[model samples]
Each structure stands twice: as C-alpha cells, then as structure tokens.
Target: MDVPNKKTVLVIEDEIVLRDLIVKKLEEIGLGTLVADSAQEGEKLIKEKHPNLVLLDIMLPGGMNGFDLLERLKRDPILKSTPVIILTNLSTEDKTATEIGAIDYIIKSNISLDEVALKVKNHLQ
Candidate 1:
C-alpha cells in the first residue's frame, strides 16, 4: 500500500553540508526531510515529529550522542517502534547499533548517497 502521508526522514548529521546532501537525496526520491545538527535536536524531533525513519550519525558532538538516543528510543514504548538506520564511519559499532534496535547500520565513506536512498526505500517500502 502506498503510505498516504509523506515518509518523513530525520537526518542527524553534525556537518551542515552532509546533512543537506542527505536531505536533498531523500527529497529527490520524494521523501520529506528534517535536518538536525545534533543528536539532542534529532531526539527532540523524533519525539515531536515521529518521523517514519531516522538517518542517525553515531558521532554526534552533543552530550546526548546517537548511541544514547538510540538506547532511549528502544527503551521508550512510544518511540521504540520508529525505524532507525545508523550511518557512520564506525563500522565497529554495528553490534551496538543493532542491539539498540536500529533496523540497519551503514558505514559512511563506503556507501554513496544513492545507496543510502536505496537502503531507506528497502525499509520504508
């Protein structure tokens, strides 16, 4: 079934350009984007917006890092169901990411933006 509402994506990337790039790619594929510069902001957006999927970066600079946010989401009954995909350079964190309930984890610098879109589509579809 076609999801009637736009599939919203909350992109949490500390780098402005990278965040914009990811958002643009998602938009190009007809997905809505919510960009956040920090995990704290991203977590707030998740609570308020309940986006369909989250493109979370593991290395956020804020005090509430991505791992912590992921953990909170998993523990919260309201937020635990939202799908998350972690995109980071730290491939070593995959086990932790999955343990925290991320649907998928992709390494940056190895995957292209298009690949990311494909991954999102696979989950959202």
Candidate 2:
C-alpha cells in the first residue's frame, strides 16, 4: 500500500539518461518519483499522482512542449499551486518560464545531480 504522506516528484524529461539519474538521486533521499518522456504523459501522471512538485524539460517528443504543459497547469485550478521547476538547457527561456508560473529554472548543463536533489528538497520544504 502507498503511504498517505509520501512525497512524490514528477520528472517530465525526455532524455533517458538524465531522467533516470534524477529519479535515482531523488529516490536515494526517500522521495517517490514518477517519470514521463513527453508532455502528454506528464499531464497524465500529474492528474493521477498529484505529485508535490514537477521538474520539466522544455524540449519534448510530443506535440505539446513543456511551456504548453506549464500554461495548462497554471490554468487548472487544482494544479496551479503545485510548484514547477523548469529544467532545460535553454538559458534564454528563464524569464519567460518565470512569467508563466514556474518557481525556478535550472540549466541542465550547469547543475549536477546533487544540485538537482537539493533543488527538489528545498522546494518540497
């Protein structure tokens, strides 16, 4: 049975290596993880799991991108308050991401797995 109080983090990243690494790092600290390779899957998981936070990647394989998902989430009454962190290689989108309701934006190439874990921890607190 799933624990009622267990905190979960959803990672919406298409890169297999990065996604797996992030999952491992968060799991090491006892946080539950849900992963999606595209924005569509991310939306489904968010609706079903109601994760505490989401780490989103801008570039996805599906028709919808991370920005679109973020916009949708912000528009939804229930999910709008959920903290979302934009994790992508695009440094230029940081301002736009914040304008769209992302709590933080981290450049993938600039941060380590440990940093990722730390960011998630901070947000969860």
lDDT over C-alpha atoms for residue 4 of model 2: 61
Worst 10 residues of 1 by lDDT: 1-10
Tell me each candidate's TM-score.
Answer: 0.94, 0.96
Q: Report the Cα lDDT for candidate 1.
A: 0.88
Q: After superposition, how far is residue 43 of candidate 2 from its true place, in Å?
A: 0.4
Worst 10 residues of 2 by lDDT: 1-10
Candidate 2 residue 8 Cα shift, in angstroms, is: 0.3
Candidate 1 segments exceeding 4 Å error: 1-4
Q: What is the model-wide C-alpha lDDT for candidate 2?
A: 0.92
Could you give candidate 2's per-residue lDDT for residues 1-125 as a string of tens digits? 12367789999999999999999999898888889999999999899889999999999996999999999999999999989999989789999999999999899999999999999999999
Candidate 1 C-alpha lDDT tens digits along 1-125 = 12348898899899888888888888899998888888889888999888999989998886888888889889999999999999889879999999889999999889999999999989998
